[model samples]
Target: MLDIAKTAQLTPDLLRSFLVAADTGSFTRTASLVHKTQAAVSMQMKKLEEDLQCLLFKRDGRGVSLTAEGEILYRYSAKILELHDEALTAVSGPKLHGKVRLGAPDDYAMKHLPGILREFSVNHPQVQVDVFCDDTPNLSKMLDNGQLDLVIATDNVKTKFSAPLELTWILPERMDPSGLKELPLALFHPVCCYRENGLKALEKASRKYRIAYGSPSLAGLLAAVQGGLAIAVVTKDTTAKGCRHALPSDGLPPIKSVYIDLRFKPRNRSEVVSVLGGFIAKGLGIVI
Candidate 1:
């Protein structure tokens, strides 16, 4: 047990290190996140473990995992850090100022990002926000070209570092199925993951299909869908209010889960970007 006196002395910095370690499961990655050497992160954990009077990590040559006690600490650490950040923002005033270029897909920008950006703006009123909408591959290219500061990229299942969302097929609610011989598609360009998966599923099912509509803009896809143009595959979040989806019995194949990667140069020195990243992770209920 971590003694009450020792627990009271735990610093936000130490807890942050532990969190980075737990999220990434790598001391090197955690070190990069905290702007310290791998050795410094290790030292902080060692000091933290001593204070807690328990083994928090299962150390091996490869990496670390939370012990039973560490898992408990990790949960409490998240809440503590969240509250601490909120308090700090309240006390520090709206001092952070700068423009941040944030990129995401049209669907996410519409369905999810508004709340995230809105909350961030309420807390940091001095910062300016610039939003860019595009698919993941193009967004990745833009990020690589230094055209964007940060991006929420919908990566394929092969993406290494993040948890993926499950994909599904979407269509108008109560769409009639018995009359159709050929499936129609209203989707993004060939570079889009949902488009590719949706097409492949139809092909594997031996169903005939035609592209009724194609657009780079997600709004176009949704509009075409609303007008009874065609069916499309998208994340559950992106599905419209009156739309329904294809189930396994409908003959659509299962889509591979997609990872949403937060793209940025870790070494970049910008407090606003760092702060925005924290807000994004917190908003999405995911640790980056």
Candidate 2:
């Protein structure tokens, strides 16, 4: 039998490495992230498995995936690290302090910013983050003009980090497309990709459409959709209660997937901005 107390002692170092490996699904990437060699990382994981007396990872063609035991460990590891960081911060004081200007589309802000900003505020209460919500083009302009430190953009060409977003057509649940003479659109500004893609798709399909409502705010668009005023384009993960997804069979043409991209101002690449950018990337599951 194994010595329970001795074998079960999990050091923060091992747990941190394990978390990084699990999150990234590659020892090579994890090594780069944690500043260790690939061989050292492999040895650490082997030791971790030996200590735990269970298989934590399974090899695949691409990289590695967590076994059931590893999944459990991953969950626990995140909480463990969170608590560890909280304890250290409580004692050592907030190490990072400065202001960061962040910009994102209103929809992205509604979907992703809350949890990320909440955790960031907890960790660096001294850091003041001024957030601006705008369309991707405007945000890009702001970043290039040195008016913003970091920006999250949708369907952007240039990116420091990025994640895929599946596009979809959203409309009132009970509204029938065939009954209407022309499809009405609720969209953002003319420069927005969602509006552009949606319009291009409609035109290619030879479908008649009119801009029924226009709004920069996600809420306004959703309200227009829910109120049955117009159909709107949104990401698949949008969960407006009264809205149903429109299919290609419903005479709506398909919109190609786009990326949620992170961008940084070259001149404003301060430590605080970097920290915030890293936090946003981690939150969005994008590796920097």
Best by TM-score: 2
Model 2 alpha-carbon drift over 4 Å, by segment: 1-88, 156-160
Q: How many collisions per candidate?
A: 1, 0
Query: Model 1: per-residue lDDT, tens digit, 66-88?
Result: 99999999999989977877787
TM-scores of the candidates are 0.64, 0.67
Q: What value does the lDDT take at residue 244 in candidate 1?
A: 69
Candidate 1: pairs in clash = 164-258
Worst 10 residues of 2 by lDDT: 156-165
TM-score of candidate 1 relative to the true fold: 0.64
lDDT of 2 by residue, 1-288 (tens): 878567676777788889877866777666655657889999999988988899999986436789999999999988987788788788989989999999999887866776577568767978999999988888889988888999998873535578887788999988888667799899988888888888888889888999989998889999999897889989876746578889665877898777888889666689999989988997776778
Give the Å error, residue 282, model 2.
Answer: 2.0
Best by lDDT: 2
